[model samples]
Target: MSNDAPVSTTHAPQAGTHEVILEMRGITKEFPGVKALSDVDMTVRRGEIHAICGENGAGKSTLMKVLSGVHPTGSYSGEILWNGESAHFSTIRDSEHAGIVIIHQELALIPEMSIAENIFLGNEQTHRGAIDWVLTQRKAAELLERVGLSEDPMTKVKDIGVGKQQLVEIAKALSKDVKLLILDEPTAALNESDSQHLLQIMDGLRRRGVTCIMISHKLNEIEQISDAITIIRDGRSIETLRVREDGVDENRIIRGMVGRDLESRFPDHTPEIGEVFFEVRNWRVQHPVRADRLVVKNSSFFVRRGEIVGFAGLMGAGRTELMRSIFGRSYGNVLGGQIIKDGKELHLKHVRDAIDAGLAYVTEDRKSLGLNLLDDIKRTTVSAKLSRITDGLVVNEAEEFRYAEMYRKDLRTKTPTVEEGVAKLSGGNQQKVVLAKWLFTEPDLLILDEPTRGIDVGAKFEIYGIIQRLASQGKGVIVVSSELPELLGLSDRIYTIFEGTITGCLDKDEADQESLMRLMTNTTTRPETPAAS
Candidate 1:
């Protein structure tokens, strides 16, 4: 965006030139019961894109926190060298003052403020002790254009979607005159087009002499954009590989991160579909914002008892809307629909009704709608079915603790105790808590929306196993995932949706990535099966 190409920087010393902007030596950070980081060493070349790869809970974020002064200097034993000199930052403000900016996974934008105001929050343009609205709007507009966002600068932050908000965050960082930029899973919430756009923006920034340190689990994106890849595992630096070099493979990078060859990204499961257990007819849902527009058109599908049904679609393909509408009519306007459970029509007017009718929906966005962060594991596990612990009018503490403890062990949740706060747990563990909450309900049908998202491979396998076990226990399971491989591997039957319609349905023996992609992209039309004579 700055119209200046990045200056090529060398990693090691060559002749009389030394090429290093930032270097962290012997970094060690410890928590109460965990050694988050230990003897980690890393170096960043000026204007180079350096990628940090690791499994969840491998201390990648912890290392970045230390660099950004979130952990402070005295808490960690490390020497941060900037421009060939030792630097100690006491706070985030101190690091920012030194031309270092970090964009966290959870964006730090004020929802109530306009885009222009958010970009120039602490660093506003003032003229004669008064705010310069015209200058601020112009600068914000230029920054937005630079980042490939076409949204109005005066638009409220809450009105725009997550992807647009991400671009705004980057623009805000540019406003700070950042020299070293850190992005933590910036593309986690972006769709395909938006993700590609963000990656290109990062490339443009690199070309404009901006040094970047990206932490991401998206292996494909990491391999494509990174100049060098560093793998960390169990709080230790494994190895750093130059991706530009020959014979550097993704498998090798994954091995370095997880310490093993990932035999299969998705676990093996043979589904034995029985009689149809859940069915929907003439389902139509209106858009949440535009009541006149339909997000999910007249769609109908069914899942059998002991079957794993998969829904595959792109970002705006109406897969989530259909599920949410059926769950409780919780999402948008339901123009017309009838849900039949076990061959009987059931009322699903609200979340309570849906739950009572033997249905449960595990939301894709776990942070906001799924779990209660402020409550403990014991509380959240039983939150959905408080009646289980309620004796007459009051909840029995002993019964609640017993149920929570059972789930803690049964689900293999990684926590010190059941009383621990859900906020303190890892992403995978939090997902398990959400699963535990629904499993307590003992529903006949379980709808999992992106259940394994933002978690490690090991945790995904565990979730897959859970799904298979649920199907084996005669509970119908419906899984929605953007990852094609996951859908093909786990589902007994898959339904492809595009533009608010079910494009195709394939049995386990008939589905593959190519076929699914064809259906997803609307390239091939699905054949209709004749009704039973």
Candidate 2:
């Protein structure tokens, strides 16, 4: 069988007397001013992989929270039936005790702790009120093996890559003796190979009779691994399709989740290329801790006016470091580099200097660096450029409100009002707010790292439209993304980075997945585009 084909031998779910292991009846979840889910009904057969499909705010995560006790009992109106018995869970521990464990898109592992410690965190191996060290290590090793991870149990979680950390989370779940495994957007941060491995592990779990429920926006993956798919549209359960060898396709899933046919995943726009407006020469950055060793080698690239240039590379390929070092020394110490804007060499010594020079960077980590969850929308919108709403010595609150309202409407940020705290908004809306924050800066150049990461397809299209609009306004755009298809679809020109160096550059017509991957891995004969400035 092909690698893309399903590993399951049985195309259908349990045929005979298998019981329904889980039933969520009349589930309605509500937040402050939003009704997330409405009277949703879902059932999962024993030992089958079930998938939930929806748009960004369609309440897939909220429904999973309700089931896993993140919402707890008395929080949402719902009836959870497990093994034909009504189950009321008041905490995550209650759900775990019942053999249901969930791994969210954001990993929950403590970074400083070792794999063994993280695995047996809450449920330690004990004897007569004393922890058993040998037993703990042995069991942690076994669970890690089950998840196809080769790392030592003594290794810390922070030292591992996200793909390996994903496996560690599964090992942690295995330590709980999970009978039902729930994964939310598990492969969003993973590459194609890592994603394939994760899918294989899910299939392995199904063969061992573990019921799995997955929520994902990747329609192809849903069509492949799932035995049944439940489509949620605007907080309503639309329909469930039972998978057969030839019964399902990507278009069907897209149409169901989006409530209409999405003919293209990206908005159409033609590039109006102009002279190179942004250029970096001989960029070299030293590692933050090990100053002797360089993290970004002699790299050079350029972006033209009204162009979307893409940086394609693997994890830790120095893309983020390069961008950060260029933007006001937010990262490592720059050993040598010249940043040129228009026709002038820029000497940006700090973040303030970079911002004043009309440069803005939207970091890849939105939670930690992009948005302040505690601040209100109005404040966040005017944060980067307070001068716009400030008087000579005092601040004008009405002007701030008006400015925030205008950008909120322009970006189509979905919130109750500009007074709504950013902590209450969804992932897509939070991303929009971040963009609004940078747009207020009136930047001539915008740097976006993983712009659409962890968002839904509909939200991705909206963001693409925003990028195209920005380009239309003659602002230079640089996009760094791990998703090759995203880079291929959006970029007017693409540069591949490997081991902190520029390996190859391809124009839009010459770039594809194979060429990009070859250059990314340094498999090309020589860089098609010159690296020397």
Candidate 3:
């Protein structure tokens, strides 16, 4: 699609028709050295999907934590009124006692537990203090049905895909007799089809008189589903807009979020294309566990210096697997492949070898794979290339701090200090830190997987500029993204992947959402344009 895609004019149904069921007055939450939320006021109707929109580190999640009692009553100075009565919750259980349940951005389910066990883990139905398996399974089955899930209750939580896992989370919430449900970035990790299904489930819950407060960076989804939107910016509530009454669109919500109209979602740039610096030929990788299965087929692609090459694919289309395998066989067993960099084939047997070969891969799952959350920013920034900060035996602390501080300022990472733990920063800042880690390696080729996955529009714009800046420095950047629009906006050339195979390639001028979708789905193939391989 073009940049001028029409804003959705559709409004939510029955907006502002119900009575106010939840309200917070002058909520102020503070940490050791930071005030997360200040005098934030919000109101939710008896049954409506309320959305919270803001840039990263704008206190949306912090506000939700206060409401759900994650911060507790005495910890934050706030008066919460539920159903016109003062409510002071001292713990998460206290909020749940009042039928308030929140599903965090990161799932809290146990991988080893069964779906039934995970659903009623802490709130199990018991008979004479003994665990009642029959009742648990039956109730879990019913809840699953309510959420349109057909999975068996006995199935392991890790066995299901992310979409189904999300449904299981909702089922778990339903088991609590929840009256008010909160979802933080619910669809951030889901594909389009699964995201739509989750939205439909939320709408169904609204009809069942369940109030929902959702914190999301996806303004388009917010525009489509929210009855009312509350835009939070810089630790304060900016404005509350009713979808029907105000006719709020993406741009309007964005303005409230960033305090200015975004004239362009992407920055304008003229390409300074150069010779091909990296090439992957006939790449094939076997599944890590399943030896008989091939995760990546005979995929072939190349990246040119000063050019941003985008890989577009659906979820489970092997995009991540391909990149990981190419980056020193990190994902699967590399059956056969040729990685040619600077016109010379290189053998990268390990991650260290990949780094030595002047290649860097920024993983999509930053929380798990890209970052060590326990470490501080200074440490994490140089962890990928400790040799740069180390003098044979010991790490030079001053050099580490200098590099961290430089990247922090250069990438515009929002943080009080480099000594702060990465877990304390927002998703955008953490991503910046991850980039800094890899950039410290001083790679000639950079592979970024879902670089802007859960970040806001403003942060995404900044990331795009950063990618372009890398390309401008004569580095070859390969971006693998689930977002088609992002590929169109940033990539000079885009390649489509399907079922572990490279389907086709298109230049910036030739690719659009529909065309790319067609190629991605393996429905059609474009002419294979030769790169510098």
Query: Best TM-score goes to which candidate?
Result: 3
Top model number, lDDT: 3
lDDT of 2 by residue, 9-41 (tens): 354444431678999999998877888889999
Name the lDDT of candidate 1: 0.82
Question: What's the C-alpha lDDT at position 379 in model 3?
Answer: 97
Rank all candidate structures by their lDDT, best first, as comma-separated numbers: 3, 2, 1
RMSD of each: 4.4, 3.3, 3.4
| Model 3, span 16-120: residue lDDT tens | 447999999999998878888999999998888899999888998888888888888899886999999999888899999999999987678898899999999
Tens-digit lDDT track of model 1 for 51-118: 99887667787888899998898999979998888888889998999888998766788989999999
Q: How close is candidate 3 to the true structure, as a TM-score?
A: 0.92
**lDDT (Cα) of model 3:** 0.86
As for candidate 2, its clashing pairs are none
- Reference-based TM-score of each model: 0.86, 0.90, 0.92
Candidate 2 similarity to native, TM-score: 0.90
* TM-score of model number 1: 0.86
Model 1 scores worst on lDDT over the 10 consecutive residues at 1-10
**Candidate 2 segments exceeding 4 Å error:** 1-18, 112-116, 125-167, 290-293, 523-525, 528-533
* Residue 199 of model 1, lDDT score: 79
Query: Model 3: clashing residue pairs?
Result: 1-513
